[model samples]
Target: MYRKKSKAFYERMLKKYPDVMSIPQMSKACDVSSKTGYKLVREGRIDSLKIGRNLFVPKEYLISYLLIRDENNVR
Candidate 1:
């Protein structure tokens, strides 16, 4: 299914990329709109670090967010 494929893709990405990711990269990985990603960053709903002109999200934060979201959906 899509969830399994997405999870596998992320696992591959984690092995290939660094612990931090740019907004665009995060958006693509989560299959979310870039605007939503920016909003999440601005609202502090998801943890991010602003490095000069680019915003970075930690891998840990992304994993936690997905896990929490999955749990909420289950409930």
Candidate 2:
């Protein structure tokens, strides 16, 4: 479960990504493996969209994942 952080917190990712994007695309952008991306989605670490058997991720959720990960690593 992710919280609704400040809008500015997500501004960077929101600018780099579309409102929604496929896992493959997001993975490429993040320079991670598609498997890792899928894992994140499946594990519920990143919110996702299941549309007609295809999984998509919203930019906001991706931003949430990135921000959270960055915050954790900075500690």
lDDT of 2 by residue, 1-75 (tens): 545456586576457677788999888867789999999899998899999999999887887787787667631
Error of 2 at 61 (Å): 0.4
TM-score against native, each model = 0.71, 0.75
Model number with the top lDDT: 2
Any idea what lDDT model 2 has? 0.80
Error of 2 at 46 (Å): 0.6
Count clashing pairs, candidate 2: 0
In model 2, where is the ten-residue run with the lowest total lDDT?
Answer: 1-10
